[model samples]
Target: MLIGHAIFSYFPIIKGWELLVAQFNRIDPEFFWMLAAGFLAQLVDGALGMGYGVISTTILLSTGLNPAAISGSIHTAEMFSSGASGFSHYRFGNVNKKLFRTLLIPGVIGAITGAALLFYLGEKNAGWVRPALSVYTMLLGIRILVNAFRKKTASRKVKNAGWLAGAGGFLDSFGGGGWGPLVTSTLISKGRTPRFVIGTVSLTEFFVTLGSALTFFILLGVSHIETIAGLIIGGVIAAPLAARMAGKLKTRSMMIGVGALVIISSLRALVKFAASFF
Candidate 1:
């Protein structure tokens, strides 16, 4: 009772609490939906090293927001979520320093370039770009699934890994998300170790997302604060757990999960693109 009186003496604590509750009550129901989306997306992304942006973007599109606004909000939230995921992966000993170094600069540059193009062009080019990227990613997913069933072969070096990272970063920023499906799938198909590839890619994603988010903030001025906040909170909460799962899953199981997620996301994108025609 004395503690409560002391707290009350210091401020209008009850009034402030009431106001906060009122603010929360007034928040759009979409915030709660986005919160759930963020948790699921980050869980998949952390474990498989992809899908957060794709999942979040798909949900946002249903809200009738334009491509630029969706991308802006997703990337802005990704800055925090990916940072947390990267640290969590690092803690789990999943990050490959060499691969991370290879992907970092090129990924950042490509992300900035893509974000700039998306800002300048808006959604005018999304029709063709989305379909093309979706088809390509779907093919990659199929390849990954097939590889999961094949006999183990000698791992081959990924030629022009920098170029692949650049392409991934570009598409992820431009199309809302494809980095994991493109870079991770390509690397795994090349016979790279799944654990290291996923971890390194997850680490690199933070920088790529940082570049894209900054670009969006500059061009778009950070609209959708509540949506971004919801995603960040949910993703952050799930990051450590997802990273632990990444470390524990078998290589084949991880590959299968990654392949399925990529295929599903790509198919969804294609369907949405097709629907736009009507």
Candidate 2:
């Protein structure tokens, strides 16, 4: 009798649940596509420590959304995904505390500055920035690939890591994604362990992305709630798997994968930018 009474007492809550289901049903089919993109992007990012934002932004751009909306939505969704990825990496002992600490504040500051600039200045100058960054990342990718064929050596302490993180954060916020390729590639190229570099960078990304997302929210407000929700769900689901892959993969294999992904993504960006002129 008590159990029956408890169930009946929650009838209003059940009615609210039904309402929520109705709202979900009304969402556009695009949510499913975003979910797939988020899953694939997060999987790659978790394993190799880059590509989430780039992949998500590229797909979003194809839908013809404005840059502000794309950036805002991607950053918002990234907060959730990065949080999950960071936690998973920590659990796997992949994070480097010193690197995370060094990268945190500077990255946040740069991200905020970048978001503000993008809002005020728009993407008028993106043409120059995009190709330049693409070329830089492509070169970094080549360097990493070359390193993979060389004998292993002791990891070196990265020089000017703070400046690197700051620049990475700025580009990530302004261009809608570059943090992973810029930060992760540079660190790995400097002889840091690929796993730790990926892990620390992924963890730092949560805070950096949070700064950008908050700034975007203040300036643009949240427009694509369904897309964000889909990405969050997909990314969260893939986080653990990706983290495990990063931890278990061989150093050489991981470096090769990271190098290839960075090169391909950069080349794609360069090609896309060039095609715009014709």
Candidate 3:
């Protein structure tokens, strides 16, 4: 009580604290909504090894945040969530060390490059770039759905894993989300073990997310602090549970769900963009 009184004696500090509290209170609904979205996205991401960014981006886009801001915010929050998820995946022995190594450097490079491009495109010409990204993500979603039905799996030895990882990382940054949809799906379709692939992807995502987030920070600064906070908190809360659940799930079902989610999100963006024209 004495300490509290002493602190309160500084009127400026007290007022600032009060103002911060008030601002937070005003955004409580939005914060909790973001939190719930983050929780679900991470749960799915952890279980199936993808979709957190895409799901989160869809939610933010629907709220009218610009593409750059949305990507930046999602990447920023993912830095924390991915780290947590990766650790959980590692603990569960879901990671493939070799694959993880092969994917890491290229993925980081791709993510950083893509982040720069996204910011550049956003600044120079945001009008069409966002829609194009939306379309691309939609296509990826379709591909994931197709993979779900294809029974023929390739040899586990992949010559293009690095390239595929690079592509996935690039798209993930450019489209605000695509890493899992592209890389994980491709690897699994090529005969990689679903549990191991999911775990490895989740683990690799930590570095990829960090690079993208840092790039976003350097280019765009911090735009959605509250959203990031919410996502990080909710994602961390769900990470362990999702990691445990990943091994139990069937691959086909996870693919179908991811595909459906991607389609819905991308379609929403496209529709909204089209509506703006008419």
Candidate 4:
């Protein structure tokens, strides 16, 4: 995580890596703006070991991309980002194939269904998600605080791993959030240590997201070719450094930071929802 943060902190000052200044010329004339979002997201993930997409997607959607499009596109972009991270963790033997396998079926199924639902949120009574998000945020904050104080443990019981992973993948695909920490937390609660859980969660998310991301392209025909390419390059170049840093990271400290962001994001989303009632 130290290296990851260094890479992140350096991106702004580096030249010849002008992803920061690039913008979508048409509707998003500032492509670099989105990359900046990606940069921050990755930094948070590096430092906190979670929440890259939640941060980036929220920022991206603020630019007016359809929420479904943001969900699909970010997942698509992060595929490469995730792919590498997953590979590294897999190499470390953190992944549980038997557990991850069960998730494949329901994950794909639920993702497709979720994406379909997201496509129409603008047309439906979307007002509901706000309060829901607020509640989710409030709860996430509480969860973090409690967990921070409690005796920490992760589950080693692979028995329910499949069900949990699939469910996490499904919810993450649909909401475009929660997959990483969700899986990590559940596995940890069951018996896995934070180290193995992080590795497993990061690694497995690659395949789960990759499959669903492809489906998004097939179904929605959306593309962010250049942006996705940029993220891949940036993410790849930074991985080795991130891997080394993550090893030295203090887990409890990292979770508290991320938990704070999640609560803030959730509250912001919910507050927007509440304001709309007026």
In the range 141-226, model 4's lDDT, one tens digit per residue, is 66765676667644345566556666666566656665665555545444444555566566666777777787678767766665
Residue 157 displacement (Å), model 4: 4.8
Candidates 3 and 4 compared by lDDT, better number: 3
**Leading candidate by lDDT:** 2
Instruction: Give all candidates' CA lDDT scores.
Output: 0.87, 0.91, 0.82, 0.61
Which candidate has the top score in TM-score? Answer: 1
How well does each candidate superpose onto the true structure, as a TM-score?
0.91, 0.90, 0.78, 0.72
Q: Which stretches of candidate 4 lie over 4 Å from their true place?
A: 1-29, 46-49, 92-105, 116-141, 151-160, 189-191
- Candidate 4 structure, TM-score to reference: 0.72
Q: What is the C-alpha RMSD of each candidate to the true structure, in Å?
A: 2.4, 3.0, 5.4, 8.6
C-alpha lDDT (0 to 100) for residue 208 of candidate 4? 72
As for model 1, its CA RMSD to the true structure in angstroms is: 2.4
| lDDT-sorted candidate list, best first | 2, 1, 3, 4
Better of 3 and 4 by TM-score: 3
lDDT of candidate 3 over 1-278, digit per residue (tens): 88877877875676888999998778768889889988998998998877797678768877788766777788888899899999999999999999999999999999999889877776444345557766766786787778778895455687878998888888778766668867776676566667898899999999999998898888889977888899999999999999988876687777677667667767876887799879
On lDDT, who's better, 1 or 4? 1
